[model samples]
Structure formats: C-alpha cells, structure tokens
Target: MNRKIELLAPGGDVDAIKAAIIAGANAVYCGLETFNARNRAANLTFDDLLGVISLAHRYQCEVFLTMNVVILENEIPTLVKLLNQLVNTGIDGIIVQDLALFHLVNKHFPSLLIHASTQLTTHNEGQIGFLAKVGATRVNLSREMNLAEIKSLTRYAHDLDVLTEVFVHGALCIAFSGQCYSSSVSVGNSGNRGRCSQACRDEYDITAAGNKFPLNLKDNSAYFDLPELVDAGVDSLKIEGRIKGAQYVHTVVDSWRKQIDKFVESGKLLSDDSNLYKVFNRDFTNSFLKGNLTKDMFIDNPRDNSFKHANDKSNAISVVQIQEAQQTLSSDKDAIVSLVADKVSQLSIEKISLSLHFSGKLNEPLTITAVTKDTTVEIQSAVTLTLATDSRIDEAAIVKRFKSLKQSEFELLPFNFDGLESDLSIPFSQLTQMKNQLLFKLTKREYIGAVTLPALTHYPKLNTQPTLSLLICDEKDVDLCDVTDADIYFKLPESFKVNDNKYIDIFLRNPRLIPWFPAVLIGKDYLESVRLLETVKPKRIVSNNTGVAFIATNMGIEWIAGPFLNTTNSYALLTLQERLNCAGAFISNEINRNQIKNIARPKNFKMLYSIYHPILMMTSRQCFFQQTVGCNKPSIEDGCMLKCEKATTITNVKGISFAVDKQKGGYPSIYNHEQFLNIDAVEDLSHLFDEFFIDLTDIGSGSKAKIDKVELVSHFENVLKGITESKTSLKQLVTISTNAQYQQGL
Candidate 1:
C-alpha cells in the first residue's frame, strides 16, 4: 500500500482489545462468539461486540470481526443473525473463509467490508481476484508464499483496487491454509472450522529417517522484513495471536510498533534492543519467503497450552508501563477472576443522577443535587442567587443551565424542572461550581459482563478392517481394479457430476464400483450433485467435504472419509467415525508414520493410510488452465468445465511442478509435484491402518512422463504381499518422490 501502513493486532477478548489499543495498533481483528478460525479463544457475544466496536472507535482503531470458518448447513441461520447484528455495530469489516458467508454478507450487508481469511488459501492473483469480485476489500495472503509470490499478488491486488494483509508475526502452519487435514482426520474437528488441534505442533517418528520431531515447524517472524513488506505495497502488517494472553499480545504489538516507526525513520532494522522483545518465538523461519527448503524450519521443542510465560526480561518493555498492565491483573482475587474481570471491565460504565430545583421567592435558592450510580456521592448545592433586573429564567434557560455536564459522572437525560418557579434570577456561574464537586466520582471505571464459552471435543472410537482402495479417473483405469483384491472408487469428473451414469455405465461394463464424490461441490453444486448421486445409489462412497458427509449419512450409504477431510490425529478420526457415522476414514497425507500410531482407532471403523499418492496442495473454483488460457466464463460456475479436462503442470521458480486437475463443478484441485512413497515402512504401519489407498489421479495428469496404471497397482500389490526390492530398484520405481516434510517437516 502506498498510503500509511496499518498495524493490525489480535483481540482475542476485551482485555486483548484494550491491550492492543494501549500498545498502539491501528486496527484489531477479533471473533464474535462463533464461526471464527480460533473458536477456542474467548470470543465476544452480540452485546460484547457493540461495546467492542464502541471502545475501538473511541480509541480511533478499527475492529474486523472474524467469520473465518467452513459453514455447516445447520449453522447458516445463526451466522445470518450474527451478520445482521454486526451491520448496525459499525464494525470496520469481517475476516471470512466460507464462500456462503462471503456471498450472504455481500448481498445483505453491503455496508460491511469483507476481508478474506487466509484459511481461504489465497496465494496468487487469480484467487485474490476471485475474492475481490465477491466484494473482499482485502485478502490475507497464504503464509506458504515466498517474497516474490507475495510481491506479485500484492501488485496484482493493487491494480484491482484491493488491499493486501500479511502476517508479520505468528505461529506458521506446516500445511497451506485451507489445505491442512491433520486435525480433522485425527479428531473430526477441522482447521477450516476453527477447531484445529494443531497436529503440526506434535512430534513425529519417521521410520527410515532419524528425524524424531518432524512436523513441528518454527513460528514465522518477518519482523526484519518490515521495511521491505511496507515497500512491497502491503496495506496492512498483521500479528497473529488470538489464542494468546493479553500480555503477549501487548508485548508483540509494542515491539512491532516500535520497529515499524524505526523503519519509517531510519529505513533499517533495530539490532541493539533485539533481545529485549524476543517475541516468545520458537526459532523463526522465512521458508516460503525464499524457497529455501534446506532451512531448519523444524522445532526441537514445541510449545503447548501449558507453556505460560510472557516476558523474557525487564528489557522486554518499559518497566513502568509493563507494571501498570500487570497490576490491573494482580488486583483480581485469582487468575480466572482476573481474566473475567478484564473482559467485563471493557464495557463498564458509571451510574449517576442529575437534579435541578428552584424556590418560589426570586432570590431564595436554585438548588442542584448530583449523585453517583452507587450513591457514593451526594452533593447538594445552593449557590448564591443573583437578582434579575430584567428578564427571568424560562423552561429553555433552566434546561440549558443544568445540562452542562462536562466532565460529570452522569449522562444527560430529559427531566421536568417545572415543580418550582423557573421564573427566578440565578447566575449561570453558580452552576459551574456545582459540577466541579462531582469530578472524581464521575471518573471511576466500571465493567459490562463476562461472556461464556462451552467445552469442546470429538468422538472416541470406530474402526473397520483393511480394504485396498483404488482412486481412479477414467473407465480404462476402472478395468484395472482387481475385484478379488481391492475395492475401486472412481472420482467423478465435472462433466459426469450431474450425470454419474456416464461413468456408472463405464464402470458397470467392467465391475460395479464405488463413486468418489467431488471435493468442492459447495452451495448449489452440493445440493444438485447430491440429488443426482442419490439416484445412482452407489453402495459405497468417498466423502469429500462435510456437506457431502452429511448427504451420504442422510442416504444411509457407507462412506470413507477422503483426503480432503484432513484427518491427521486419532481424535479427528474418532470424530469422523462416530460423528459423521463414517464406515472408514483416510489418515492425512500430511503426517509421518509414528504420528499415525498416535491416533488410536476405535473398533467400529477402518482407517486408510496413503503410502503412495500426489498430495493435493490447494483447491479452488478459479481454474489454473482458465487463468492461463483465457476463458470467458462470466462466473465460477460456467465456461471452464471442458477446458480443465486437460491437466496442466505449473512449474514454480524452484522447478517444483504442481499438478493441477479439475474435479466436479469446475474446481481445480492442485497436487504436489512429487509423489509420496514409503514402501519400506509399509508393512510396519499395516497394524495401525486397514485400507491402503493409492490415489491414481496422477496417471492422467500430464507430466514429462506418465506411469503405467498396471505397474502402479502391481507395485502396491507387491509391497502388500511382503515382497522386498533392492534399494536402487526401489528408488527407480517409488523412492524418488517428495514426502512433503514427512522427513524435513514443513
């Protein structure tokens, strides 16, 4: 942004809001009760939001409410209620992830600005442009981007009249935003739904490599990149810690504020007091900023909820100022009491009354009584009355005389002052002295009330025996499925979604097979696609998103949780099995071998682990092929369907090629360049998981060379049969693929 850069901080609660303000941030982003990415944080209610907006406005700061979560069909009405109440609150904007929420807010509450959440996985201009067309005022770039990628997107956004916001400090996710499935697969709770278990923070034990703590990524700190980010035309510099305590928020905000000011004046970073505000960071990494895969982004010791310590030393912040915030918390009866008190104190107000009186005699007395809300102050004044030589006081004059409550405890209200004679002589100067008596009493602070949140958890156990699942794209690939050994699932293409019979016809020619539903048939696509698929009534299915899971459950069909559901932990898997009533679920491709063992399964359901497959890196309605070769599709729903039949391999600066394939509804699902392979450790993980899936979409995805479908299937069968190959022979067939930090960790 060419204008003054806005410093955005997190307001997890009212205390954090105040701390951000006191710490000198230009804007604060917070969640209201529900539907936010960090639902575990102490969110504000409808009433709390009114006071929050009022307080933030009072301090000349903006408040952007978080509506960043995948919308469940049942939660729409509640979301509408929240949006309606938010309209009148004069909230600066909203941070959202769901497309439904974005559309609803844009259509109904035109006054409210929308800032797309990073959970939307916005990386490039095409995605950001898609959001801008939907009325996003700003887009939070994905944390997985390099500086070059960010510069390009920011530049593109500037042309579209959209602002760019990037995280300058925060806990970085190992998976791309909107793509990580580790939490959901493990616990049925979703990162997209704001209940992320942060499985990336967990330790992993790789079978082949000696890397013990593989997935724990170092937190991101682009602090020194302040000037460059500002120069990169970012409209806002953000700090990400809504789940943190107030002192941490204050410390981070204060440090960034000072550094920003220093950058503006000196155009250089601070080296001297660097350790003063060490930011409680777990060793920082700018991995995506430079495409440095060799960088040490993994953490040896991951921080948990129990890790509670704010200051590193006195050098962290100015001593006197830090104590003021500390003392406010210390004054409370206990730790919990202090937290609740801070939330309530945010909207606290003083109670008071104002009175005016007059005697029948012209010079008798004109009395005023002022009392505080608590009755702590009772001031009675009978000022010296002046004799009126000409005109006497009228109703209007009386109202004016006592209405001057500047610096008073009580708010002004309309009251009848006709009991006594208003036609009396009184010096206005006498009224001035009366107000001075109640100054101290009016200046005391008070609070509104504390908001409560409910406890949350996922399901327990459910498991099924192993069934070799094969994911295919065409009718020819379906013929290769050996009915005697494996269960086949064909991913329905965008063209076949409305009429699965085309693929069903092809499948019936060979053998009856399960249908793999689209990963992103959201909104109308969800309703229509589910309607058509129900007619086919396939015995078994693959559930892509939560909506599909609901649809499948309603029809009483057996479903296996697909890779898109993001099942990484045992809790997430338990959630999917018991909550969604799923027969089986796939373990997240994001986790290593030992992490899979941690998710102890239940007896009723089966778990499928992918030993070989191209990991889907990103998914979107904006097709890459359409973007590359011009498509005149007026909206996301049209024009690009047939264009996406041919897969395009997009190569980045680092020569990493991402395979882009479009599923039903013209949505592009991008896969990583290298395939994931762990053949040697296959037999070892067999006890933990039952079904082993090999997603064969890679067969048709156009690359320099294509693998024979028969060979890939046979390779899996051979490994399953306990057959071993030489080290050199294994790499030639499977070992030479990327594990997506299955060893290095993201």
Candidate 2:
C-alpha cells in the first residue's frame, strides 16, 4: 500500500492548530515557550505543549516540538531540564540545530526521536551522508532546491533508508538556509538564535548617483512571489506561516488541503476553476522548483483584492444611437434601432416604436398609417408621409419644420435615408487585454528588481533628530595584554601532588584580583589527573565532569573565576576596580571599531582548542550514558541486525560504559582522540617551577585517557617541551581552560 503524503501545518496559536487538524493535517509542528524557533509567537507553555501532544496523539497525528535554536553556554542546564521534561511527556520528536544540543540529548535521552532542523542547511549528498552517519532519521530539505534537485535528493536519501521532507506552501524566505546574514548585519541579532527582526520585509531604496530607487514596490504592488511547492513524490508538505493570523492559517490550510486531495484523487494538481487566490497570496509562482528561477519569480507586486469583499461587481452599460444617409424613404419604409450592452442585468427596453407626421399642403398635420422593420411591427397611424417632394409647395420650410420636431424630444425627423442595421455588440475585449498585460508586467518587474534599504532620517520639519552614540574601551583589561599588565594574578599550591589513592591539592589564589575580573586557574593536580586518567580532555570542563570541582570549592576561586570559570573550589579574588576596568576596555575596543562591544576580564589560564572531533552538544550536566541504554538496541531489518536508535557505547579499561549518541535531530557527540593535542601553553604557572599542569579536557578522549595512566613526574619533561612547541596563545589557553572548567562544572 502506498503511504499518503504527510500534510504538516503551523499552529501559531490554539485556534490555528485546531483549524489545521480539522482541515485534515497529518502532523503539526509547534514551538514551546522556551527554546522554540518562533520566539515571537505566544508559544505553548509546558502545559500547553503536553496538551497539544495528547490532542494530536488522540487524532493519530504526530506532534513534533521545535527546539531548534542554538544552545548558549549558560542555557545548558535549562535545556537539559526541559528535554527531560519533554521526554517524560511522551512528545514524539524534536527538531534541533545545534550539534552540541544534539549530542547531549542523544546521550541522555536516546529513546526520544530527533529531527534535523532545516537550519543545518544540508543541501548536498555529502551533508546528507554526514547526517545519516550521525543518526538523523529524517532531513528537512532546504526550500531553495528545484524539482530535479529534490528528486535527486529524495532518491539518494531513500537509497540510504532516510526519510526526506519538503516544504510545499508557505511564506518563502529570500535567503538560503543557514546562510542568511541580513538580520545580524542590520540589527546585531542573529537569526540562528531565533532573534531575527525580519529586516527583509522592510521597504528599502536602491541609490545610485544620489537618486533613490524603490526596489520593494513597482506599479503599486509587492514583487515577491509566494511559492507553492507541491510535487508528486514529496513525502511531507509544510506550510511556513507560524507568525501569521488565524484567518491566514485557515485560508491557506483549506486551499492546500483541497489541492492535495484533488491530486490524490485524480493525479492532477492545478485546476482551471479552483479559487486558490482566495487565500493569502502574493503573486504565485513555482519558485526554483522547476529550474533556475527567472527575474519574474522575485517580482513584488500589489496584493490581489479579490478575496477582500466576497462579491463580483463587474456590470455592463448599453448605448443606443441613430445614423442616416441621403435617400428618399418609400411609403412602405419604417425605422428601427438596436442597442447592445455588455453583460448587463436588470435590462429592459421601455419603448421600441417610431412615429412620424407630415404637414405640407394645408397647414394641417397628416397622420402616418404604419411603421415596420423586418416587416414585424406596424404603426397604423404613423407616417403615411411619402418622400415625394411637391413642386408647388416650399420644401425648405417643410424640412425645417420636420427637423425642429425631430429635435424636440425623442423624435426622428423625416429624412432621406439608407438601410439601417441593429443589435451591435459592445467592445470589452480591449479592456480585458489591458488588465492582463498590466498584471503580468508588474509580476515580472518585481522578481527582477534588487532589494534596497529604506531611508529613515529625521526631518527638521517634523521636529525630530536622530541620535547616535560612539563608545570606546581600554586594552589592558580586555586580556589583549599579558596577565601582569591586566593586574590579574594566579598562584598554585606550594606543593602539587596527585595519585590514584589520594585526592590532589592544587590550590589557586588571586589576592589582587578585582570583583568580576575574568580569570581561570587550573590546578596542576587536577590537570595531571585528567591527563593521566582520561588521556583526553573532556569536551567541556565543568564541576559535574571533573575532579577539579571539589578542588575549586576547597580553594575558593569563585570570586575571580568571573563568568567563564564554572568550578567553586579554586577561586580568584577580584576588586571592584578590576571589574570596571575590564568592562571599560571591552567597550573602548568596540567603540574604536564602531561595532558592538563585548565585556572583558583577566588574561591567563588554561585553554582547549577543538582538534579533530566535532563538538556535539553542550550541557549543564552529564546525562549521555543514562539516555543510551534504550537507544543502543538492534532491530531486525530484512534479516539483518540494524541499529534502530543512535546509541553507541565504548567501554573503558575499568569496564565503565560511555554512551555515544550520534543522532541527527538530537545533540551531536564528538569522537576520536586527535582533537586534544593542540594545547600550546599554560599561563601564570611559572611559580610552579618548571612544572605546568596539563588538562586532558583540552585534548581528545584517547589522549586524555593516555595522560591519565602516566604520573606527572615521569612525563613532566616531555610534556613541558611539547607545550612550549605548541605556540599556544594566551587566548587559546584561556579558551581551553574555560571550556574545560565549564565541562567539569568547576
């Protein structure tokens, strides 16, 4: 049996969701109040999400939650908690973008379904293969693909046993997926973070030689063509208006529903009698689906108003006129006139006969007997008047009198005449032709025009002036200089000792550090332990994942740890002055460059650089192993064992299981040990006297594990030489240290 194509619709609010479901949608993708792509939609809360899940499941429809935004370092805890809650609520699947988040979820909640977000911009076969390797079940193809490309992609993906989904109808974005920079450049907000301000929709002017050109509107209409992306082979059809109103939702859903049904019933897509334009539409086009989209596809034009007032107002008018030529009418002659109107209603002819009287001989009017046309109507008392001119009588006076009578009201003069023709049709073909031509030209022009920026300068007449500010910061506090110049200091414990039997005491102190000063201190004992035990630095260094957590708490490094330091054991004390200084420095640099400034802090510490493996998802807690149990099972497929879920486990020498979930829709997990050897140096550790601690979180898993097996005293000599040769910059050191500490929860 052939599976019916899935119809997916947007549910910005409850009503829209209900409407879509009633209209026969197979699935609905929506966002929760947090971490959803649509930040502006009065999105569903946790309760609402649960409710929606129940409702959709009741209808045998699947509900997919969108947690597609990039996860920030600080937001990991909240995200993890949310994921746990969502899993417990029986949500069918999640759509996500950040790889780290993907890994985290796959590691912790492996049973949950993961769908790769379109924002990943997977366009080619290589990208698809990559996603497949990472365990992505379905890939939402980018809207920019043409029909042939989609067909090729679908075929390729099908061969790999991966499901492919495509967008069929909705608001079309002007930029390529994952490649749009318009929002960030215009508003200092990244669309990847769900903070886009829709700068693309604003009106702009294209200026050359100081003359501004209107790029958005031409001939009083928007130029962009809304695409309808249906094809016979598409697995799912998605609509794109999550921010639109319910009316728009209803109309679009209804129209597309009809189209899909008709296609299913008859294998025909478009209908000549369909009222597709009655829904919310800008000029309709096939987009790049057919091939290279022409200039006409981008044309912005005036909106059609046919759907505004649900009525037809076109009416017709009639005009009647009489013409005559020189000829004397015979006594049997009668006059008739025909009037034609275009599609007229309530039409009636009040009178249709003519009368004539003659006065030539005795100053008395001579009554006519009859008037007929096509020998049909006879006027018995009219015009027995003949065209013969009496030689004795005055012809001019009679003619003049007849003309006066004819002109008096609705009368016709007795005159010499020719044959008459009636029932002429009105000409409306010219008007119809003109209207169609105008519409076509306008649509074409909009697609060909380039986008422009709008002018928003203040006018003096309006009594308004634009205000702007310039800011600057000092360099010393921004970690641009060496640690000493920034007035930040670090000290290790007098004696660092590490052994498997005893907990190491590697104290970190920053007595002169000011409050809020950004600094990191990695104890030699903890670093050496990770280096020897894990062999590779953990991808993230936080209290939850490291031995440094207890050490940082005992040493009290919280104050000077600034924002990046996650451990509470090893603390750096900071003064209020240093905090202000760092902030000032960051602001000063931004002001100089005319860019948005970032806050600053202390200079030296340990740093980790990503080497060979991709950083999957970042999280506040360690949950990957717990989520892998149910995910790693093999399913019987075609008499072969196939991994149905994205879970993989690597056992350590100690026989501890480490879960690796490489699913596409969830957080991505990094592997291989090559990424850990890039660390260059450790700063502010000269006091340790030729002994610098190496943190394994800065290296690959295998490397960290290798480091764990060797004692610092035995390998110290070669490690020191390797560190010096690495040419690690102060920034790189700090980056690795901060990331390591964060992962360790230090």
Over 4 Å off, model 1: 206-208, 272-279, 304-746
Give lDDT tens digits, candidate 1, residues 62-133.
999998876543455566666655664567899987656554655466777989888766654445555666
Candidate 2, superposed: residue stretches over 4 Å from native:
206-232, 270-276, 301-746
TM-score of 2: 0.42
Give a tens-digit lDDT track for model 2, residues 1-746: 14577777887766566556655678888887777777777677665665566566667777888887655544555776676566555577788765545455554666677777777655556445545555567788776666666776777787777778877665555544444433443344556666665543443332221212111111111011212233335567777767754555555666677766776677665443223344445545554454433333433333443332122222212221111111111111111000111111122211222343322223222322223231222112112222333332233433443332221111243542222111211122322333223223322211111122222222111112111111001212223122222222222111123443221111112223222111111223334433322332222222211123222332433311121221111011111112211111111000111111111112332211121121221110112222223212122121111112244444332332222443321222323222222122222212111122232222113223222212322233333344453343322332322223112210
Identify the leading candidate in terms of lDDT: 1
RMSD of each: 17.9, 31.0
CA lDDT of every candidate: 0.62, 0.39
User: TM per model?
Assistant: 0.50, 0.42
